[model samples]
Target chain A: MTSSNETVSREIQLAARPQGAPKDSDFTLVERQLGQPGEGEVLVRNLFLTVDPYMRGRMNDVKSYTPPFALNETMTGGAVGEVITSNADGLKAGDLVLHDAGWRTHALIPAKTARKVDLLPSISPSAYLGILGMPGLTAYAGLLEVAAFKEGDVVFVSGAAGAVGSVVGQIARLKGAGRVIGSAGSADKVAHLTEKLGFDTAFNYKDGPVSTLLKEAAPDGIDVYFDNVGGDHLEAALFAFNPFGRAALCGAISQYNATEPASAPRNLALAIGKQLTLKGFIVSSYSHLSAQFAKEVGGWIASGELHYDETVVEGIENMPGAFMGLLDGKNTGKMVVKL
Target chain B: MTSSNETVSREIQLAARPQGAPKDSDFTLVERQLGQPGEGEVLVRNLFLTVDPYMRGRMNDVKSYTPPFALNETMTGGAVGEVITSNADGLKAGDLVLHDAGWRTHALIPAKTARKVDLLPSISPSAYLGILGMPGLTAYAGLLEVAAFKEGDVVFVSGAAGAVGSVVGQIARLKGAGRVIGSAGSADKVAHLTEKLGFDTAFNYKDGPVSTLLKEAAPDGIDVYFDNVGGDHLEAALFAFNPFGRAALCGAISQYNATEPASAPRNLALAIGKQLTLKGFIVSSYSHLSAQFAKEVGGWIASGELHYDETVVEGIENMPGAFMGLLDGKNTGKMVVKL
Candidate 1:
């Protein structure tokens, strides 16, 4: 469809706080007039939007590292876009940049907030929102630093086919981790982990008990457990942790939407007994390591040691459905919306 | 009491496993004759015995970093003793040393296992079990390394009048922490923290809600939290933690004897939101830093920048009661038994 220059901008806003699982009514789509880019600002035509687990925590009104999205305000998210107009110095019109432009077709953002990407020689610009951006950094920092992985250490990644997990398993292999095991929600995802991501062993969490499966997969015991889905996965990893083991707790997707309080890990005391170190971290905390991460992870990808995948949903209007599917484990790899 | 040499050879063993908390019935005070020290071994007459929270986790028959105390076997603990007989070249009969000797009056230990403490003109040998040994090293490693304290950061210590907490608060203050707040179970203990240990503020947890008191004590929010008593104290610290705060999970005494599983923290998710780091550590993991710790903490103690207290119970026969009392929060600082 050809649009006039005076056409209104389409946007999505938070309608209500979710009780347990978010419903469609929790978000509302509305239209507003597009404004001119102010000084030191660029106007972008958003091409793709990202849906992630971390966004669920942002929807709640409770206090967090970053403020919660105000009710009725535009729902915020990371997006990749092409600059339509620029008053900013470095960025020019038609340049592809990654920014937290929220769930909208067009955004006027400060130039500093947008990172200019050279999508020519390395990879596609969408990878910046998926494997090469927040998700990739989450996997790299959590595994390398928080989990303290050394070569020959047995590593396990839960939610193996998800954005962060996929990258975590691949990075573990690249870092010479021994016996990289993974768990996914479906058989297809499980196969994808071992076949595509180079995981030594992969289990479908829905097929059987997690503790039993973890034992079968990692017979000797796990040294580093990268947990995306917490609950039973955490309990299993704790039971299977060897002495001096480490767990990098990046996300606990399983307990995020629970109406009642979640149960404590059955073997939580094992942390002290095994002298294990369990660290809960967010990717932003280690942002200072980004340049180093890009150099290392980017090189690994170039060498074919690291690989990534994305599940794209067409159009900005489908953002809520895409996010709902993400929480339901319906999407494989990084889930994004193409507008 | 000076007695026949034969009387000094008796040892104590575990007779049975206690159902909940350990009981005197679980101990068997056997009178086995002493054996001659092997080559590179020494005979020790135990002086001071350590009764710590970590021992509680070992009471159950389970795999841990250190194996559980076997039924009808000696219960191991850190002890300071004087070498009575030595076949080792480096150790003499009068040398004061520390070793992992059990609940016994006498022990035959390998020379390498026994660490000799050259008695300082101004310090007592018993300091090895309190301010200069495991507890002190624990405080140093957890506070400086795990919590990553920088000058002017506000610090909060739980179980603040106990062994590790007392040292942690003093060391943080010595390191130029802007404010040091502590929480204990009673008015006397709270007073001890503020008056004797240099805490900027101290509160009796029994007074009211812990989160409320913590907020009042640390109005600007705590930058570093040294957690010794987990459960409510941990929850309170999480709420009062500042942005980019660090939490050192040294011990969790409150949950040691819970008959029923403890409740999950209401604000546990805050760890991710505030970009907070919660690191659970055991002192043995950082044993490599012992010499560095000794240099720094020893200097602090000698210069009067740090102070430590010990709650000594006399006689080896009273150890069970001393241990039970330690769990009951009766001890002011390091709970040591002088035999």
Candidate 2:
């Protein structure tokens, strides 16, 4: 018999560091006791949890932009949930908030760390973990700011069916791009990119060599490339770029699970004669664009000019599965876990 | 005997396309007759010819930023000469001018294609072919504009004893750089880089692995990398860069003669987490900075604050040999044929 002031919560912990591709044995679900909110703190009942590709880097103990996840400790990520109890100003029990306490059913966090999210009519709380969140902002900043995209430019994006890449391709089209091209893993995703996402052209990278496929798809050459899948995709983009072309290197999902180091992009010397610019950036550096992003992207969503997709997995116990599936390209768009 | 209005000229022509490293058999010395200057034309007595690494690209039959050299035709490059006769208003007899009619003893060219050079007492006319000319502007624009160099940056220059790299290292030091490090092919050039060129530290790339050498030289990491030798040098720079580091992809002399494609810079994926910016540029695209470059670099040379060196290879017939020698890293600075 638990006390009324105490609650039992189930949270996911890192059981072991992944060797290459993560396995079910690498994560474990553990139950913990949580007390009522202390001063300036709130008890959150997590409704949605996000599993992004970047988390793969955090599982490794190497030094990177973000610290690695500790072994046997609860992992943290993006979450959207309702405030169950609050001892903080401007927060109440029924209010919804976006935070970084994901992979768990509940979190007791400082109020300052949680941002109150207003529940709109049609948008679900899960949207805060996908289209209306980090992935959306990454697409906006990487394309417009990092890649320096201009109207009427030919744009190519890799991993076109994934969360960030799908939005990148759509945004390029909506922004008056002359032609938008995409490369994905499957034929259905290729069709989905062309027919549903408004991509002028799309190809299944598994069909043949990316360079030959890219050359056939973009005969005139591409001015901008939003690189989500690295390795062969990056090498192909380098070969297909026209002079003065620019590429925004956002992620390398293709090499994330590989035990061996990536070896493509052998034609980097071509950059010298082509006068290309390849800039790598993370979305956190561009948080200053959030207000402006919310305004522009929010307007597009409201008018039904922009489209978004999500693959939701049920239960906190399945969060690790959802994350592994996300890395394996099992999800078409943003993969989120629902409590 | 030749008439006053007619002259016999000796020129070098491309005999065969090189399979890999260029050799003497790839060139042939030929004699041709030149007529008097026509309208807007001038007859020039060539004084010096430049042998640069970029000329190796023109030897191949591939389409690049510049057109490939035609087979059995006179090979053209940067040259400084004395105008013997001028039908154009701006040029006069005995005036020193710079033009693109190299690998020859004499040339009949249009005045519009030639720029008159002002000969100073202390500066040699051949300086226009090296330190005071294209290579200088390449170093100037590449360091300041392409790399976006600032005052407190720790800079690294590969091929630091070569024409452009030497100037690049010197400029970085004069511009208040926090530290300057350079890598060369030989022990003597390495010593010259640190002792004569004001580089804070220098290393002979042949000693060991470039990554290990660079790590030993730059313990704190580098902010700007002016890459002249690509391949392993570029890969090392990528690993040595700090957060938000920038690299101006100036040249890849190491791979110019390679029959196979280069496979280094294997660590380019590090750019994502480090937020690196790698921009490739050509000197021709930055001609707008010429006047500024001349003023600043000219001032530094005049005050004896900057130093430049040249390897003078005598005779027009030796141009092919000099060019081959340059590719083999036989020259300390600019390699010019004194005709």
Candidate 3:
């Protein structure tokens, strides 16, 4: 498909606001006719569409860090695509680009808003949507910058097998963390975290109380925590933290789908005696670290010091299922839809 | 009382560890034989004893920032006293001093551990136990350093009529805060916070839910929070916080005496979207700021630009009752026992 008037694009739209957990009927697939790129715009065919946990927040018609996805309109997110035509300087046809126009088969984006990428054989275009992308940067900045991770500091990360947590554990291990502990939802993911991801210890949070499991894993206490799954995991981290402990709160996947308010982590008062620092942040705030992150993380990937996994759901129609599955912890790492 | 070998001192001892809220039976007044100053020691007669909320934490038999008060022993805390005799190089008779040896009418302490103070007609020695002492430094460091308070930022503080919170609100106002909001338990304390302490707005927490009261008090949202009373107050601050808000978790007076765990502030997950930073700290960790705090807060007091109130309980026999009253919000500003 090129930037011709005959080209057609299939996009997913929010059919209804989800009450509890989103179902198939909450989304509607629509096909729209494509037109040629206008001035300072480019037409691209999306190769991979990113399905992230944060997307669930956009599904609701509520004010947030990002605007809510309009009902019956194409929902937008990160996508890696091959540009078919460009009407702007410095961008050309056949160039691969990364942009936020996903949940669709194609995108017509402003040239300035689309970032051109190098096509490498060792890495896939989808890597831009996972490791070496937002999730990877989230981990890098959340650990090194936000959490103030230090050498020989014991590091604990929840959602250990997910995209951000996987990167966080590996980076801590590579950067000489005294110990790295991870918590996942499944035994397979727990095994993957310890065996493949080089976490010093891994536990399935579903097995028992998170506080008990975390205390058993990190007997000496953790100095830094990279929180991806909130709720009990955060409360447990609070219990397992040593004096002056730091936690970078990135996401709360456990509470994302809840219709009722979150009620766990009641032990937040423990922070006082322990003198803990809990900082919550969005990855977008640390865009200044993108270059440094790419260089360091890219080097780790190239040298095989870091590893990443992708659970790809083929076809644009399965994007919603992939996203819902991602939230349900069905994916081991980054969940993406290949169109 | 003047450092005689035959002098007797009246002291209060912790008879038993209280299960919940401490009572009169938990303490016992004792008569102890006093001795003259030994080598490098000073014998001081107590003038005032501080009764603070943190004493509640020390009453519980648990490992914490401060050790629990040993059973059947004289309880120790901040005291301002006048030295009668000294056996150290720079010591002299009739010198007023500050030391950590309260719950007693007299103290025999090392001269190095006792800080001599100027007996100013404008300020009483008791000011060293309240506005010009540990509580003063706590408010200064927690607001300016821990919370990273900035000029023109909206500031909200819980327990705003207490020693720490009153100072926190006044300092913020003096330093050009855009707005200052305070919460106290009683209507009188609320009125005192707004009318006397210069808080732009004040609310009695007993009026309604803290979140609703806070939202009404700070309509534009708070940029900084100095939390003295945690639990629901923290949850309310979380809801009233603007993006990138910072909270200094100094104390959790609300949950200190609770036999069970705290359950409020369940909405801490909101920190992620708001990009909030909550840091819990102890005043001892910030002793490096003592000189600066003294210079600033002392100047504010001397210039009459800042005002402080103290609820003084007569006699050392009422010390335990004063401490219990402090926890119950029976007094405004600092609660001290005048001996």
As for lDDT, the candidate ahead, 1 or 3, is 3
RMSD (CA, Å), each prediction: 3.3, 1.2, 1.9
Best by TM-score: 2
* DockQ values, each candidate: 0.38, 0.83, 0.82
- TM-scores of the models, in the order given: 0.90, 0.98, 0.98
lDDT of each: 0.86, 0.93, 0.92
lDDT of each residue in B220-306, candidate 3, tens digit only: 999999999998999999998999999999999898889887887878888998999999999999999999998898889989999
Alpha-carbon deviation at B25 in model 1, angstroms: 1.6
Question: Mind giving the per-residue lDDT tens digits that candidate 3 earns over A117-186?
Answer: 9965679999999998999999999999999999999999999899999999999999999999999999
DockQ leader: 2
Which candidate should be chosen as best, given lDDT against the real structure? 2
Which portions of model 2 show Cα errors greater than 4 Å? B1-4
Question: Rank by TM-score, descending?
Answer: 2, 3, 1
Query: Which stretches of candidate 1 lie above 4 Å from their native place?
Result: A1-4, A35-43, A84-93, A108-113, A121-125, A266-269, A285-305, B1-5, B35-42, B85-93, B108-113, B122-124, B259-261, B303-305
